[model samples]
Target: MYSKTILAAAAIAGVQAQSSINSTSGYLNYTTVTGYFLQDLASTNVSTFDYTATNFGLINRTYPATAGLKANLTQWQQFEAQVNALNADAPLNTAYKVLFLGRHGEGYHNAAQTFYGTPDWNCYTSLLNGNATASWFDADLTPNGIEQALIAHDFWAHEIATQKIPYPQSYYTSPLTRCLKTANLTFSGLDLPQYYPFVPSVRELLREGISLHTCDHRRSRTYIHDLFPTWNIESSLTENDELWNGVTAETSDAQDARSKIVLDSIFSEDDHTWISITSHSGEIASILRVLGHQSFSLSTGAVIPVLVKVTFLPSGPPPSNPPYTTSTHCAAPPVTSIASLAQGCVCSGTAVGGITTPIFNISSDYPTSAGYQATDLGPVVTSAPAISSYSY
Candidate 1:
């Protein structure tokens, strides 16, 4: 099934070599895998939900204004630097995949009449509503929510078994029950065994509407540390300490820093690895934007398994007289087909006898002029070609 054919009666081709070019030490590579959004499945206009005002608190005039504040420039720079470093260290064929940003399916907030009944109220009213009675970080997944996690698990498991795509080597999660539950469900199906860490800096932001008690924070830390001893909890959540009362530290800045550290540690050149992260929609979207993808949405059951490939070229002189630069490409596996052959199929047109052949067949036997029968003969069968075109 594999052969190289060249039909060149007359053809012209051009190749160029540039002697001077700046050789960058590294490049940036990333991909965003969007999870299933509940709003999308409901067929409701997400624009109406006002993510800026409701989920993100960006549009709120009360305390946290949305657009005026500049992103922490220093942290942003470090984040970018880490990405570039990873690109440099990654193998020529390395690809990065980011996944699991979505809402918890059908929660108590959605079931409560007082919460969902009010329009212009936050979609995440369970956290907001200023109700101390509500659980802050450890909200149990509703029955439907568990089903959503299962759906994501099924999708990921299928990808691993059929496509030979590696399961993530490391795991990360927000300190929220729903997020942790989602991670558990996904890891349950995969064969890989690895530890995961929970970053409270990222998780605290998701708990914006909920009042965080010291006890809650302590419990959350212990839960994650038990699973991942190497977790950087002290660095991640130290800002909550009374010692740093005067210093101004934004959650966004902390998140940016944490992402840099985590990404750098997880991605390596030795072996093919996958990393899974379960986090809230807001934090996931923010991380995606930081990674150079401006448009990404997370749904309840949505699972985005990003495929990131990294490559490095030889380092050369400065911009004045540059050296050869390496290139990298990032792509998500298609949602429709996970099989290895189908995954690699790309169409190129080269007519054998001024006729193009179908890339895929629905059935082995195509109806011929003589009769309907299965035949392994060439395209021309029973004195005539049985088919003209096919689509998958």
Candidate 2:
């Protein structure tokens, strides 16, 4: 995360939730789900303005300027406005598009774990191990994950209704079931027919940060298509998870290279200027970098809207459509494995620390950049050593 604060334009509309300022954090964190999204969320609340039909504006959120992302977005918005001023007959107008990027809701792996108050050397391997007591390979969203999607869906629906946001003419998702499910859940009930198309296709290039993590391992294409019949899978994608091996994974540079190819295609094709991308938090960071911005962190199920502008010279070959390819390169460090410790807990994660009670911190014996939230995560591990009483 960067130090620059961004303009927050998307406030919760018709909210009846209660919020209190944390004397320590110095930000208003709303903890209720009374807002129409039908899920709990924490945001920096600025006002209590009630927007009615007369005073209309529904805001989901505005992206923070983390890691130069907001700066890139700002440049794109300016470029787009300039393009609109150019004559439609001019050749440059067709070369650019704006895409909205987002992450999936909580997956089973995201749910805290069940060490069950005692460590099992066989069952609980390294923090990066996916062979947990309760694991979901290439997982689907948990119930709480579904709710998070609904909240995003509600936000998009409201924004579309008020014309605060544009409708997506093209939609793409990672082949992973979790991402596919999240894309569907988020746009299922849009007021516009085209908002949620009959089929949202998967793009192999959109897969999560490839690594040794089992959760990153994808099932065969036939298996995924069998589960989601209405959706379309890329014919070029290999039948099996050829891109990922539990042994060797795609590095950040490789993923960034892939992000570039996919993004160029998305921007160059004359199909649609407004697009949506559903992918993982790790990979999204790479995508942001390929677009000429520094990467920022995203929690599970969080979204950041971006207005992308592709610059085309007076003469050049158009970008290739689909069948995009990227070279592999950078090894991502191991991410910690999270546990569900208790049943009925929501599954979510964030690399950034926040107002929520701290679970795993830098002080831990195995301090990790990774963190989990949703109903007690670490009391089981607290007594292991000089651990502090965990709260989040």
Candidate 3:
């Protein structure tokens, strides 16, 4: 519900003259401009591309606008010039932006999912706060997750130093704990422009799909602010999460509806041409769907840069949003489950549970920093070994 324009980046030399579009007053259309980034190419497979190693997927090519700049600029510098030129020449109703969508580093829940297998995790373990090993409720980034974020931090530092890549003028993150921590670690200590710091706004709509899993339930807003004091908590983010009810899982249609709403809010209010969003795999997928982009799943800690063209339109009928559906899960670990998470598992006992109520409380004693230990919670039932790589 909270969105705002970032005027700070307009001070950048080349972008100051761009025409502005009134995205708030009318309906809007979003389209992804292909042929610019390698990630968008039909031939480039996402399964193998490591964005950190590939200059964040910027194609190695020259832009028409770059001829006026220095002769030996890096590919990213040339690309930045091209984006600025696009914005500068855009019509009154159209605006161009480069959205850097990044998925958070591995969380304990991701590790838990891998350890327990998809079926068991989806049916039983995912509902519990944590087993003996660690807590996945509003799951924190594991040590490996921290390492992945640090890799992103180093990648950003190198990009800014060598490629002259345009840093994000405005930042946004999901209200979930893993995303909050990932955004902090990924952009915190970089040599950013004075006007644009790593102060990301915590957005409620950017959270993961409502699956009624403990990991999908977020902590209180106050806890988020206390952990990262400098972050901008969205104005409408309630002190406690108001949307999750632990009984119903959001349908893809429902998720897409909210994703469009959040994207529309951002496009209307935030005028910055370069933006960054840190969120989960499912939510990011929903955003890509809303933006009319191809289905490219991101590995944990991976980043994708999208060039988006948004046009304001006359108001029309709103899109239909299907209601959330009740998720039936096993009360205890199932004897066997289908590989697919969408299907129900087979339980040994006759008892089955439907997610209808919240199970965990957001305690004030939640750790204030990332340095807290699993031992602080209790003894380990089973150790969740650090996973180097995995995706949703």
Candidate 4:
């Protein structure tokens, strides 16, 4: 009788031990899967005084240099705080996969040249210094552009080395030259292998006046099929269309297609552990919107990673979308109005400590030491991160 009891006790202990091991392994797996996006920050907020209803003037007028500066500064601070919080709240074994979205650094194009008014053929001229032979779509990154890519690359490298997130398995870019250059520089800086699968189909919808229905054509579907030969692009497209209205040439449609492509690629293959994509702000913003993020803007050289959790059970349907939610802690800061002055100067806080200082130091540095000392640092910098105009 005592032997029987002892045997039962041993069996119970073994089962408990096995369950504990499985639980630990599951936890470790959960921590390692993450996705990220980075973008060139553009100020979208416009002041009431400067409001103009015509020609998206509302969006263009609010440059990072002027009224929108303070908002951008606040957004970055909030985003960084969210990142820190996620690292803290997640399990110690969790790792991350980063997706970076950015605008090509400053180019030769005139800022005043509006996309709506400018001809597509002429678009390349200002951007490419009138060199017709040069490929406008794939132009080289400007000097400052390279610097921006390095900033993101260095930050990610530090995070991966110290935080234990896996290096990206693939790097994707638009067919455009500038985007390609940015991706190459980033991968080279990180010392990672390059895997380029041209996604011209992704860019098709972004072309001047393509319709959502046209974007969904079999030809477009075929292109996706070729890029990801094993995945069912058609089915994914169908699903996305159902969820986000039909796919059109509109920025919103392009975003839907891109997000679906990404999701399908990740789920289709088990071998690929991490992926990274380099694309524009409009597309990135759309993806973020679909993922339930309210309004988080991407800054130049900034990277936003979304950590999605998934589970495939033996007896249940796969969750419609991966269990992913962005960190709500990264909410944008409250808006503050600056009093307009007739002649005196207004200054926002300078970029310091990798985080924008809250207090805008509005002071004039004059020759006289006494005058310089007396100058007051104005309101904090609230400008939005510099975002590239999609029209370009």
What TM-score would every model get versus the actual structure?
A: 0.42, 0.56, 0.85, 0.38
Question: How large is the C-alpha RMSD of every model relative to the true structure?
Answer: 28.2, 18.0, 7.6, 22.7
By TM-score, the best candidate is 3
Cα deviation in Å at residue 9, candidate 2? Answer: 33
| TM-score-superior candidate, 1 or 3 | 3
Model 4 ranges off by over 4 Å: 1-104, 107-139, 160-164, 189-248, 310-392
Residues 1-392 of candidate 3: C-alpha lDDT, one tens digit per residue:
12223221121227432323443344667899998888888898988989987889888877888876658888987787787777766665577888999999999999999999987888788878788879898899999999999999999999999888888988999999899999989998999988887889888889999876878878877888888888888887777655665556788888887787788767666767789999999999999998899898999998999998877665645655567777767767777775454446676664443333333332332364432222223332211111111110
Better of 1 and 2 by lDDT: 2
For residues 1-392, could you state the per-residue lDDT of candidate 2 as single tens digits? 11113211111111111111111111111111122111111342213322222111223333232233434333223333332332132232223334467789888766633232112211222123344355455766889889888877887776656443445667888988789889989987677564446367688778887653446667676766777877777776666655543333455665665676665444433245556889998888887776654345666777764434344333343332222122111122212222432111222243421112222221321122121111233342211110011111
On residues 94-113, what C-alpha lDDT tens digit does candidate 4 reach at each position?
22222334444433221212
Candidate 1 similarity to native, TM-score: 0.42
Error of 1 at 258 (Å): 6.1
User: lDDT: which is higher, 3 or 4?
Assistant: 3
Superior by TM-score: candidate 2 or candidate 4: 2
